[model samples]
Target: MPSALLIIDMQVGLFHGPDKPHDGERVLGNIRRLIQQARERNVPIHAVRHTGPDGSPIAAGSPFWQLLPELELDGDIDILFNKTRPNAFHGTSLAQHLRSGGVDELLIVGMKTQYCIDSTCRAAADLGLKPLLVADAHTCMDTPVLAASAIIEHHNATLNGAFARIINTADIQF
Candidate 1:
């Protein structure tokens, strides 16, 4: 199946603030490697950035709203999608963009495993787009109820086969 890499909400703000995702550096490295591989294979790469209301960490126009510096923001090959909702396809041109490019599957990676990543995967499946979640390339901060690692594990286990197939970044093949 034709696939595009969908990196969601990998913004600097997620790394800042008092609460940050666990193993952020490692996750970033994994995502970077995946991006390089995707580029080498000429697979389309799309980045979805979350935009929050005013005063939020990811509010539009704020420094934190920008993508992390590690990402290669090449306009020629990489596409950017700004989203106000957790589901990147909600009110966004993501589905149309994918359809127009003949992309049938999405290799997903990025932040907030329990939120945007989870939402987007389920939404993708509903939209008839196969989603492959890169297990090691996504992260989330510890919540009051659960540890970050547990959240990641739980999502990977629950989402697999239902919404997406959870795979490691190193196992990804274009």
Candidate 2:
């Protein structure tokens, strides 16, 4: 099984400030665990950082645009993908990179459960890649209409068994 780990938008900006996602610390911890497991298995890890328009927190060159320090991207094996759209594959070479690496399956973990994480998972499936979403490894901020926990729950239920198989971080074999 050729597999890769796709971590989407786990930037510093999402962790700091008042707009932080719910259970962000736990999410980051889970993502770190996934990274460690992937490294041990020699599974490629690709990180997608979202770049926002000028003046936005995640704008290019902004401090927040970078991935969180907890994620050890110093390894030569780590790959980085930058995107402006919700879907990581949009305007990015994520699909090509995966295909080139002979990666048929993707383990997704990241921020904003209802946004980039959700979009990327669906896009991966649509692009003929099998995606396994790490249920507890993604998160989002509370919206005006729904709480962050609710949003997370909603996405977990909706995306699971549909666009991707939702698995717990511990349940992931690699």
Candidate 3:
């Protein structure tokens, strides 16, 4: 199986803020375990950082835009990308890069389940890449429309089959 792991927007601004995403601590632990497995299998690991407008929390080149220190990416093992849009493939070399590696399937784990994670999954499917969303490893803050837990549930139900295969971190093989 040609697979790659996409760690989308797991940055300081999103995770280390005053108002945190739901189940963030547990999600981080899950993501950390996923990274370890991917590395052990020699799978490609792509770390994507989301860029914000000037003066915003995740502004480009700001400390907040940096990936979480807990990640500890190996220079030779991990690839990095900075995206200004919600979808990781938009205006990024992601598609071509994945193709170069002959990656037919993508394992996505990240922040903001509705925005980045949802968009990325749909877009990846549209581009003909199979997306596996780690249900327990992605999260978002509560919105006026729904609580954080509800949002996660909604996306998991909606994205499954149509855009991606929903899987749990513990059940992931690589």
Global lDDT scores for all candidate models: 0.91, 0.90, 0.93
Off by over 4 Å in 1: none
TM per model? 0.96, 0.96, 0.97
Clashing pairs in 3: none
Show model 2 residue runs off by greater than 4 Å: none
Which prediction has more favorable lDDT, 2 or 3?
3
lDDT of 1 by residue, 15-111 (tens): 6657878999899999899889888999999998899999987899799999888887676769987999899999999999999999998999998
User: Could you tell me how far off, in angstroms, the CA of residue 85 lies in candidate 3 after the best superposition?
Assistant: 0.5
Using lDDT, give the best candidate's number.
Answer: 3
For candidate 3, give the lDDT of residue 45.
Answer: 96
| Candidate with maximal TM-score | 3
Indicate the worst ten consecutive residues by lDDT in candidate 1. 12-21
* Candidate 2 lDDT over residue span 70-153, tens digit each: 898754679986899999999999899999999999999998888898999999999999999999999999989999999989
